[model samples]
Target: MIKKAVIGVLCAGIALGIGIVIGHFGISSGPSWLKDVAKDVDESFIERFMAEVNTIQIQENLRELTDVPHMATTAGDEKTVQTMLRRWLDDDDGLDDAWREEYNVYLSFPDANNPNKVTVVDAANVVKHSIREKEKPYTDDQRDPDVVQPYAAYSPAGHVKGKLVYANQGKPSDYEELSKKVNLTGTIAITRYGGAGRGAKAINAAPYGVAGVLVYTDPQDINDGFMSDTNETYPHSWYLPPSGVERGSFNRDFGDLLTPYLAAKEETYRIPPENIVGIPPIPIQPIGFEDAYVLICALDGDAAPFAWQGAFNCTYNLGGPGFKPTSAFSNSDVKMDIYNQEVIKNSANVMGIIRGSVEPDRYVIYGNHRDSWVHGAIDPSSGTSVMLEITRVLGRMVKQGIWRPRRSIIFGSWGAEEFGLIGSAEYTEVISCSSFSLTLHGCSYTLEKQMFRLNKTY
Candidate 1:
């Protein structure tokens, strides 16, 4: 908690402080009031060097990092990590040494073909409902079919047909109510995405022999009204647009499933298929509320309990046996064509050091993830820009021999975070296994008495 709080303050302070510096000096051009304020502190050299940490530079950095989809285990992601390394190595920054620590990570994700799909048909064999299986963006970089599709990572790839079952949030209690009305043996669990992590919905349903799981975010959950209809979404406001799918991993264990509790080293033993934990065996896919509406209205059964209601226009029904299976199989079918390939690939973790003076052994680490599902302008590119600006200012201070710290600081830019916390978890595992602790006088890159350390990974 202390570390988190300290880093939060540091990030906020660095951005705000630089903005103030630019406003009072660069933009205002040292107005009479600014000159008067500078007189009190005599205008330190660090203040004069504040040009490196301006808003323009920050935006430029953000633009560069968010230019492409840098999903974990992709070439785009590698490009982003290398870009940061180049910045650190440039002579202008005046840093000591920078290197990328690589780790072998296993990842599961959809491909360029948009492999996942869902369809709903009625007993008459008429396609009553179906999703376009796509996203519509209000701005550039927000929507790209080339990006990973709206499917849960680690979902087993297959196709299944069954009756639709509206299980509310798909929690245990919701399932208990579902059991009262129907048997889940050959059902497709359709639940609104809420009340828990999106992945949990599929996990909870899998044990009941559910054929498949479909999760979608209802607009009413946004701000009490739908986007565009009542308020702006994306590019205009932060609210998700109709086609926005909240993409995320469903790894219940919360880390790399294959190599838990240990660094994913080349020699580390890997988990077998059956032993792999925290991932569901059933196919799972996420969709926008627009697509969900079609299936929700097609459902025909008892209206769900009052507490199970959502913002949908029709009553939420625990849909059923679907016209008694017209011929052989039920006409109500839910199908998924998921393609999540897993491979052992290397991820780069960039660690840039700034040696400390008095308490060199003890460390303060500043860290953030670099990988994103798409052009992650908000999730990480924004945070990455802040980290870069902070590094620029701190490097300038170190070069000018000003504002040294008593304790060593490490700046960490973690990679492969989207596929679970792969980079940091691997680093932490290595540290734990080696029983490694920061050396009191490891090596000083800045100065002998006072040091300012910075490290980053993505």
Candidate 2:
């Protein structure tokens, strides 16, 4: 019985040894099997495509384009479009054919004979007062010299100067509170930048006979330091002039050159040249607190309600001095040459196509706006470069014959997006109207959906 048991044990030990050998070979060759899996997946093509996409060139392109003041209705915007076309579409190395298309869109600016230029009144008096009282001088140059002066696109021009009053946020509630606590009629109002659009604030102040308006960015509202409570880091010091900062007209309701809803309509609606709202009747501009401090200190009135105070590190005040008329002020007139004409011409939309063996008609379209405000680095170059790099990688895969998508892949770099989504919108509308088998808008959401579909099918 003992001998029979020993023989049985030896047989079990041999079986275990063979099992161990098989497991060792399988573990040692795992990576080789993975390679085969990759080959089955068209061999790391997707991975390479993604790696090429995450390049630095993309960011540089975007920054270069958006770094300037290219408002939609300016000659500078045309230059921006030309630059975008050259960078994305006019490539000598035949990777793809990308082009820009232009559409005649109506835009307007301030009319002549408008008293919309900002002027500093009683400057001599303010300066004299500052020096006599040993206070900080009211330096107009302290704010951004190149700051895009504030103006409603279609504002009727007029001029009046009244005692300046501080209205916080300029909201309806704030206006109600002002009505109770102080008289705003025949007063020029100054409001901080928050709560609503600058146009709304100006429009609300206009009904009260508030002659002129000055909007300013408060330090408390926009932080300067990293990890600060504010949404974005302050681009410049409070004392410096506001150059290249983003300033937009929020007077969409009153109708500006580019009306939001009208921009998307089928029948193009054009505002008459004479009636476009351009600048405030009274001159308006944004100033930093350093400049605002001089204006605020000159106030001769009751102490400002606590909630109406700013981050000037001083008590706020409502100009009063017993509500008695004390001083009159006037602004120097200036003229602005605003160009608003449509030059309709042929523009191109560049496209690259990769034919799919299985379903060539089904397409995955990818696009990014190539135009910039200035050197539009962050606004577009970043995304554009990314798209370009992605195209390059896919092109390489096709060249190597290593990868082929089941559905056709179409890549495009759009133009005139900064000028109210002109390029992309036109393309979508045209393709939709035509009998194209499949065309999709390359917006953010659509891109995500296309990616998901590609993953599932590929």
Candidate 3:
């Protein structure tokens, strides 16, 4: 009996192995009619549809969205969101009401009193001092100095000047080394751009009584040489236009920085008070190494470690005068207005649908975010524009009566994606939770019969 049981188990295992192998490599030997149907769908419809994709429109949309510094919780960002919604609606070409309507999801940040406000010092001075003599000349006419100011959004406006200290990448480890070797109390810290996010550096500086924080991209980080040949040096790609490469700011963190979700309300969805989690107290800004070099050269402290060496073709140092008494340096108090107002409580998602003749309920949805950080051409507009072109082509196909899909298609252009994936996530949850029946064809003999009967009656 035991032998028989062991043999039975072996046979069951063999059967399971066979099933796995077949599932991985098996080709369906079903009806020839199904193959013919699939072939027709590909050749007659999908081929023609694919040919209509417009690359030009995709590039144009990407360039426009990423062209500016549109931070969340700002007027510029709101305008950008509305502009995308309007453009998608206008471009729908008569199929305006084919899908469900749109809605908005609100995201809140800290108010002025919150500690997240970053202080700025010598803003004009840095721009003026670094532009002509210290900074490299712009090779392209398209590069705008006004727009290129390296300031983070939500930064509290202020100006303070103190003795500057080179803090390497301004990471935790860099600070640990500074604490051990040198005293950095009551002084401004200048850091370079690589390690972690820029906000992390600013947050670190606040407790150290750091009057201000300055971040910049070193020459070794961005390029090998101080300046590159005009045409070859710029980071342009065919997939991107002249201004397509995004020189974006680094200020992203989980949850709303202005409001801290407590243990009880962590999962709850609601905007907290402004100035909850955002970095305030000290001012922070990022700059190019050219600007950083001018400040570093003026430092009167000990030389920095070998690891802190920059690509400046010079020895890296901490400061010249060494550790100074805390009383020697003075802190300048700066101030700025933090703007916070709950404006319009409405935003929308643009959606279009193409109904299926055989199975009208089974949906295949395609979507992309319409809102951008700036012009947002590449990050999302490239994909959004392509989706739009596909919609246009599919509409034309339907008009000609040459194509009839088996599954319904829903297209969406989402808003406020940069702030968070609020629009898409909310829409999905609402649709999924709502009671809506979907009819699917070619599911099984019994299911297909029911679907076909329902379609016939309707």
Q: What is the C-alpha lDDT of each candidate?
A: 0.71, 0.50, 0.51
The number of clashing residue pairs in each candidate reads: 15, 36, 37
> Which of the two candidates, 1 or 2, achieves a greater TM-score against the reference?
1
User: Candidate 1 local accuracy as lDDT?
Assistant: 0.71
What is the Å distance of residue 195 in model 1 from its true position? 2.1
Candidate 1 Cα deviation (angstroms), residue 252 = 1.3
Residue-level lDDT of model 1, residues 21-91, one tens digit each, is 88887664645545543444435654665555677777898899988888876777888888889876667
In model 3, where is the ten-residue run with the lowest total lDDT?
443-452
- Candidate 2 ranges with C-alpha deviation above 4 Å: 1-43, 54-56, 59-76, 87-97, 108-116, 123-156, 224-245, 253-284, 321-375, 395-458
The prediction achieving the highest lDDT against the true structure is: 1
Tens digit of per-residue lDDT, candidate 2, span 1-458: 99999999999999999999988886665554455334455446656666656445554544555545544535545555665545444333223344444444443333333323443445342322110101122334223222234444334445554556777777777777776766887676667888966666777776666655666666566643122213333332333222212344434332224333343233566545445452344444444455455556556566777777766655666655122133232221111222212333233344555665555566677766554433444455555555555665666666667666766676655555543455565565553522334445332222321222244311
Candidate 3, residues 1-458, lDDT tens digits: the string is 99999999999999999999998789677775565446543564555666665667555644555555444434545555554544544543323224333443344332334322223234242221322211233434234332323344444455555556788988878877776655666566778877866667777766666667766677666665343334434443222211122233334543223322311123434555453454434666555554455556545557789888777655566753222233222222122223322322344455666666655666676666555544444456556555555566666666667665666666666555554454465455452322234543322211111112234211
User: What TM-score against the true fold does each predicted structure earn?
Assistant: 0.79, 0.60, 0.59
Error of 2 at 276 (Å): 7.7
List RMSD in Å for every model shown.
15.1, 11.1, 12.0
When 2 and 3 are scored with lDDT, the better candidate is 3
**Poorly placed runs, candidate 1 (over 4 Å):** 1-52, 122-128, 140-145, 227-231, 321-331, 432-437, 440-458
